[model samples]
Target: MHDDPRLEELVKQVRASRKYSAISEALVRRIGAAELCKRATLQDAVKATKKTLHQIAGLYLANAHPPYDAWLRQIIQAPDDTARRAVLRSIMNHHTSTRERLPILDAFYARVLADLGPVRSVLDLACGLNPLSLPWMPLAAGATYHAVDIYEDLAGFLRAALAALGVAGKAEARDVITDCPTDAADVALLLKALPCLEQLDKAAGAAILDTINARCIVVSFPTRTVGGRQVGMRENYAARFAAMIADRPWRVERIEFVGELAFRLTR
Candidate 1:
């Protein structure tokens, strides 16, 4: 019997949460039917049960990442274009502010787009709300802008955003893990997505780089953890990222920002 006061309080809170109560009951039913391990203390037993129930309903843990779905819901309900734009900006990751993310975006149009030779097409992969930042990307006339994400809701909102912003672009929902992206564009943006992809599958990041046909691919990673901890994450990701693309003959141009590490990989 582990008589921890902290454990007792945690169990009480979980029991009181309506969202978790049904899930907890389902778990207890399974455990009881299977004759699972017994805890001497009832409170301790509840705490352990709560943890198992939480894992079973882990989809509710969307609170950990960017609130994209919630923001999208709010956007659809917003009254006007201005209000929708505000909702869209609210979901931008911590790297960027509610308005413009970083100072680099000011010169981004000139640096990435204009300097990349003839970019009549752009492909944004695992692109969150970046298409909303089209104002920052000074694309030439009649350029085909394509964005992709896993969530269908994101695709719907992004397509609406593009039309509202008067940008000639299309957004598609895709599961990059299962299906490979077949879009061909002059420039592809894979911003802060490698680490996330790697978490699902170890070789997915490299596979995506190889599959996407783009003359110039711009890849980025966060310099610090979401908690703002610079615990050697930058150097670690940098080394692995560089090694991942080393096989290809990519002329990598590195850009170091306070929040993110970016590379413009071209042949």
Candidate 2:
């Protein structure tokens, strides 16, 4: 796709920004190619690409390039699981999405994922620091966890954090919208991800739901905006999610928390 000189140049320009440099090349190319098609010139495409990137990801991060190496070292040197969980929570607080979920972190996973008994494997797509909540989840012995995100640095940090926690899984930097993972798993977690994904492509939500290979999928949406405004988002997202899965044969169960709304779809 980058074969076109214009597209290649667009990708370079978009990634040139320190804020977007760590995003996967696949995602950069995907959005850049689309922008190149719509915009009249390479500069226009580059500007549009950065705007889209900020909407989909940058806005959620408190810092574009977090101190992942330092966080990793903190996790590695923690005295026990309790200490590690504290470090993980601190790291998660840097992202708006995860920070909001912190209030209910202790019960969020247990209640939402309980129906899928004995979770042995999981696929977390567009995962930010949510994977750090592994301590709160109930997993079977030797369970494998697979998580993917567009940020290369964050993905690397998650990979090392998982290893440090003695969990069995791999975290990778992937543009799931373009390259969805096909690995079969007991459950797939799309926590507060669909809305952000739709910012890039309107059909991304349905596309991801259709492609993920899992027996159960737990999808969540924020009930309030980042600024703590309640604007009927709950009702809006509930209806939107209903429409998104209206054609499927899966059984859906709705779960609501203080600031988050979730649905469990079982096939």
Candidate 3:
């Protein structure tokens, strides 16, 4: 597909848009190629690809150019963990998905990670600003975290933030659907990520779950729309999640919060 001049032009057009310029080129190319297969014309493919990009990522970011440098300076200058958490909370509010979880942040990690004793490593996929919640997780001393997202800038910010928080890990801009991370970890976090992944590929949720190398995987879904309307998303997503894991042998446990539904799969 890369050899096709039409597909190449489609990717260039999509990336030329200011709104999508920072997205992972791998993701843009992947979505653009798929759109080309379905659309009748290059213009149509570009339009469809942009729409999908907005749904999967653009809508979540309140600020396209967040002051990561300033945030890092604040984190490093802060006197203690409380001060660092305050700065992290402010940064997280910039993402709609993470903002919605603020109300439940205190108990969210505790409940989901409670059973897993002394987590030494984590793999956070489609991570967004979720890694900022590291201060609240029950991590062992010198725990390592690996986070991945499609936005290059976000991944860069996360990489620096991880260092500032004194955690050892790496973050990268990756198209998780096309190239899911294979690194082994004690726990893998797919928090509210399946729905977004499925938006790109119907089988993405199951594919990632099957391929991720972790002893336990934590998956979550938003129970409300971005507009804050409750339309039985909890029930809908729960049923879908059940179907995804029904054939697997991993034991499953369900947990529900104010605006999210989560499931923990242990192998």
TM-score of each: 0.66, 0.97, 0.97
Please list the Cα RMSD from the true structure of every candidate, rounded to 1 decimal place: 9.5, 1.1, 1.1
lDDT of 1 by residue, 187-224 (tens): 89888778766754689888888898899998888777
Clashing pairs in 1: 96-101
Q: Please report the TM-score between candidate 2 and the true structure.
A: 0.97
Q: After superposition, how far is residue 155 of candidate 1 from its true place, in Å?
A: 0.8
Clashes of each: 1, 0, 0
Q: How many angstroms is residue 176 displaced in model 3 relative to the true structure, after the best TM-score fit?
A: 0.9
Model 3 regions more than 4 Å off: none
Lowest lDDT 10-residue stretch of candidate 3? 1-10
- lDDT score, candidate 1, position 157: 67
Candidate 3 structure quality by residue, lDDT tens digits, 19-136:
8988999999989888888999899999999999999998898976677888879888989878888988998998988999999999999999997888999999999999999998
- Arranged by lDDT with the best first, the candidates are 2, 3, 1
